[model samples]
Target: MYQYDNYDQAMVDARVAEFRDQVARRLEGKLTEEQFRPLRLMNGLYLQLHAYMLRVAVPYGTLSGKQMRMLGHIARKYDRGYGHFTTRQNIQYNWIKLSDAPDILADLASVEMHAIQTSGNCIRNISSDQYAGVAADEVADPRPWAELLRQWSSFHPEFSYLPRKFKIAVIASAQDRAAMRLHDIGLELVKKDGVIGARVFVGGGMGRTPIVAPEINAFITEDEIISYVEACLRVYNRYGRRDNKYKARIKILVHELGVEEYRRQVAEEFAHMKALGLNPPREELARIAAHFATPAYESGLSDDLDRSDPDFALWVDRNVTAHKQPGYAIANISLKPIGGIPGDASADQIELMADLAERYSLDELRVTHAQNIVLPYVKKADLYALWKELEANGLGEPNLDLVTDIIACPGLDYCSLANARSIPVAQKIASRFASNGRDAEIGELKLKISGCINACGHHHAGHIGILGVDRKGTENYQLLLGGSGAEDCSLGTITGPGFDENGIVDAVEKATDLYLRERTEGERFLDTYRRLGMAPFKEAIYG
Candidate 1:
């Protein structure tokens, strides 16, 4: 995990102090809600339906054991003993008091974490693949570059106010776990002619108008990434729609300008920035890279370790993945319980995970985009014992990449923008599929639920996407077919009419059952859908 340097530490400490003063002023009636809204948002505080929600950024989803423990402490001390991990690889405390937010920021800063730019119109947290450093197929780790961008964008004077919020994701692997195509700016690390480079995708995003990202440039040299990104931002900041908030995202800009014109404008801006010497400092990048070198590895594993346990095999198969190092595995902790809330971990669960991360795995933890926790490096020989501990703590759910692994948003229950309750919808759908006893039978189906058009649940990328809409004050869900969150990502197509809350789960089951019958041998839901197209599933589901 990357620790904060003097500059990082100093900036956060100052922000905390400043926010503390701002909170005092607001409470004393010196600042109005309108006056204080932007300030609070910049500090990651949101005034939600019933209370204030504070979002804490877990950069590229990586956390130290100590940092994880501190989050648990904060959950116990300031919140309702739980936190919700979001799609952007961040955590949200939904019941924070306005008065206690500054103290929360201060505590987080002490642990080398801060909520800065977790919200508002500035460049948000720079995200990368959760398996960045350890994935065997990676061309290079993308976290150092993410951190470098984080430093450069933090409180950037020019881009602080944009037409709307912006997001950026970086990936260094052939597999796109971070959903790079769904971001405003997506960068893929590549190598060309013996030189390291990046493939840049600008004006790619998801929301009401979902567009699969288009390639702006196939290969951008490593030295030009910063300037190129700045160019993209400048073009958007200048030409994006400002009349309507819904049309302000970079995706809309891409839609209106057409890909070619957008690319040309960004290129023009990049040349100008280069002429002005506005590129990110290479020395600063080198400094950030030093903080994320590979962790210390032990030479040998115990020869007398148990390997025949069925529980161990299940855990190894479902919760663990291949690691870059031999004899080690990357353990993924599923946040989805059969019918439980997605991404909500109690304080005790958090403590137990922190303990496990420190004791068995490397002293590192990560929150994943799929709303799960990851222990990046666990020894294979220790799988059984670790599984036992995790089961005891209610954190051992071996359902990764399965139907129960649902991605859901905190819908009408918390979000004012939501049209319906997403969590309950997710819970019911998960329960229905579990009842059918076909969770494993279905295999590797991503079911995403979003409450509204914002697409926070990434409904556009699910193998089966459910979108909640307000139909005459009644909760109705619109089904979409053939969405995929993979290397060849595509937006789902609408199936038919919306279903009521209770009817929605059954509808999803119908779709899945259709897949079980129509799929070719050993084919995933996505492959089956592609092979047969949306018509087969749509006819089965709708009819």
Candidate 2:
């Protein structure tokens, strides 16, 4: 994890002071809601349907044990007893009081975390693979580059107030674990012929108009990434549509301009920036890289983890993944249970995870976009005892990439923009799937639900996507099929009409049954959907 330097600490402290004054002014009637809107948004504070929501950034989804403890403290002290982790790997407190926001920011700053860039139409938090440093397939850790982008983009005068919020994700390997294809800008670290570089993909995003990202260029040398990214942002800032909120994302810009023209424009702008020496300094990047160098690994461990305990075996089989190192494995903590809320953790649970990170694993933990916690480096020898501790803490759920591991949004419960309650919908689906014990039989599947078309749940990328809409005050869910979250990414096609809230679970069950019956053995729902198309699932779901 990157430690905050004096400059970083000072910036956060100063911002807190500024916000403290702003909050005071708003309370004193010196600033109205209209006046304080942008100010609050810039600080990651939102006035939700029921109360104020404060979103705190967990940069690149990394959290130290102490930092996690502080987040737990905040959740317990200020708002509800729990916090919701977002798809971007940030956390949101849905019941915060407007008067206590500055205090919350202050508390977070004490732990070297903040809400900066977590919201607003600006450069948001930089995201990377949760399995960055430990993944077996990784060529390099992408966090260093992510940190560099974080520093350069924070409060950047040139691009801070862009046409819309900009999201960037970097992947360090051939496998797209970070879902890079769904980001505004996706960078893949690559090595070709002994030369290190990045493959840049621009103008890829999801919203009302979803587009699978198209590659702009391949194997751009390491030195060129910054300038290339700057060029993409510059083009978006200049020509991205601002007249309509729906058309403001870079994806629409790319669609309107055409890929060839967009590519040409980006190259021209990048060349100009390069000539002007506007690229990020190599020395600065190296400095950031030093902070994220691989952690020291302790050699020699037993892989003979106790599999006698069914729970332990289930966890080992489902939650833990192979690590690049011989003795270590990555442990995934599933947030979705049979009837549990998705992406939510109570204050006590957060504290327990933090403690586990310091004790059993390295002092490192990552929040995944799938709304799960990942202990990226746990020794195989320590697996049994670690599982015991996790089980005691209620953090050991043995479902990874399964139907029960749903992705959902705050929906009407917290988000004012939401049309229906996503959490309940997610919980119902998870329970239904688990009770049947058909999740493993169905194989790896992604079920994502969004409150609205904004797609915060990443419903567009799910193998089975559900979008909730409020029709005449009645909640209805629309199902879509053939959606994928992998390399050959594609948006889901809608299946028939919207279903009533109760009908949704049945509809999903029908869809899954169709896939199970149609798919060959060992074929995942995504693979079967790709092979057969939407016709089969649509017929089963509607007919």
**What Cα-based lDDT does every candidate model obtain?**
0.88, 0.89
Model 1: colliding residue pairs: none
Worst 10 residues of 1 by lDDT: 298-307
**Evaluated with lDDT, which candidate comes out highest?**
2
What is candidate 1's lDDT per residue for 446-513, written digit by digit as tens?
99999999999999999989999999988899998888766788999989999999888888888889
Instruction: Return the clash pairs for model 2, or none.
Output: none
Task: Give TM-scores for every candidate, taking all chains together and pairing residue i with residue i.
Answer: 0.98, 0.99
Q: After best superposition, candidate 1 residue 113: deviation in angstroms?
A: 1.0
Report the C-alpha lDDT of model 2 over 485-510, residue by residue, as the tens digit: 67768888888789987899999999
List where candidate 2 sits over 4 angstroms from the true fold: none
